[model samples]
Structures are given as structure tokens and as C-alpha cells.
Target: MSSVSYHISNLLEKMTSTDKDFRFMATNDLMLELQKDSIKLDEDSERKVVTMLLKLLEDKNGEVQNLAVKWQNNRHTRHYQWREKKPKYNKGG
Candidate 1:
């Protein structure tokens, strides 16, 4: 795997660490990575990241859960904006 992918994988694994601080740091790093336009993940990796974030919502730590919810909301809002700006094609019209 490329160095970037390897680093991302490591961060994702760290996100699930038993230590709350590690998880918090990992989440913050992942958020920063996601906000970068140059950082793109394959479909499967993207799905995995989203699934992991969603799972974080059920974390025993309140801070982790709150951060997960915030990230999810931000992701959804960004997606909505992208969809709004993307041109649509009419089929069979």
C-alpha cells in the first residue's frame, strides 16, 4: 500500500483504541484528513471510515460520541452541498 494509505489505516485503527485520548486524537486527525481535498479514499475505504465513525456514536465515552455525531453531521452537510452543486442528467426525457 502507498504510504498515505498506510498512514490512514493506522489512524483508523487508532480510532478504536481502548485509550480515550488515543481515540480522540485519531478522530481529530481523520477529520483533518477528510477536510483535505487531495486526500481521497477508495469506495471500500470510504465506506469503512464512515462505518467506523458511525460505530463511534455508541462509544462509552461521551466526548467520543459527541465528536462522532459532529463529524457525521459535517459529512452529511458537505455531501448535501456537493449534490446541490453537481449537474444532473435527465434520462429518457
Candidate 2:
């Protein structure tokens, strides 16, 4: 499995790719790889990816928009789960 950072960077670049097939392939690959165990990323990087994907969702091309939505939803789901499981801490008053 490729590094999450590398895949994210590649996906961000390829999301703007001129070739529709390539863009689709790259997006799908990124999504699949994200499901693997080794792709670690901090919250900020995840947010950046979500923002980028939200922009892609507005693309004029139907296929691109569809793929964007797919990634966005998957990321959203992951974030939701993460937030639910994250440890809650509070400082003394």
C-alpha cells in the first residue's frame, strides 16, 4: 500500500487531470487505498482533502462530480466514526 500522504497528494493533483478516465482511476485508487491499514493522516490533512473534494463535487463534468461525491461521503463517514471514537479530555477547573 502507498503512503496516505503520497496518495492524497497524487489524488489532489490528478483530480484536476484533463483525462476523465485517469481522474476516475486515481480517485478510485485513493479511495481503496484509504481503506487499508497503513494510511495514517492527521486531522488537518483530512480536512484539506475534504475541502478539495467539495470543490471537485462542483465540477461541470457529471462523472467527476459523482466521483467527488463518492470520496466526500466516504471521508465524511470516516470522520464521523473518528469523532465518535476520539478520546474526550478536560482540564481541571
Q: Which numbered prediction scores highest in TM-score against the true structure?
A: 1
Local accuracy of candidate 2 as per-residue lDDT tens digits, 1-93: 346677688877887788877777776776787776667777777776677678878877788789888877777788797789778888773
Candidate 2: deviation at residue 52, Å?
Answer: 1.8
Q: List residue ranges in candidate 1 displaced over 4 A.
A: 84-93
- For model 1, what is the error of residue 18's alpha carbon versus the real structure, in angstroms, after optimal superposition? 0.8
CA deviation > 4 Å runs, candidate 2 = none
RMSD of 1: 2.4
Candidate 1 residue-wise lDDT at 37: 69
Tens digits of per-residue lDDT, candidate 1, 1-93, equal: 877788889989999899999998898888888888678688778888999999999999898898899899999987787679779889877
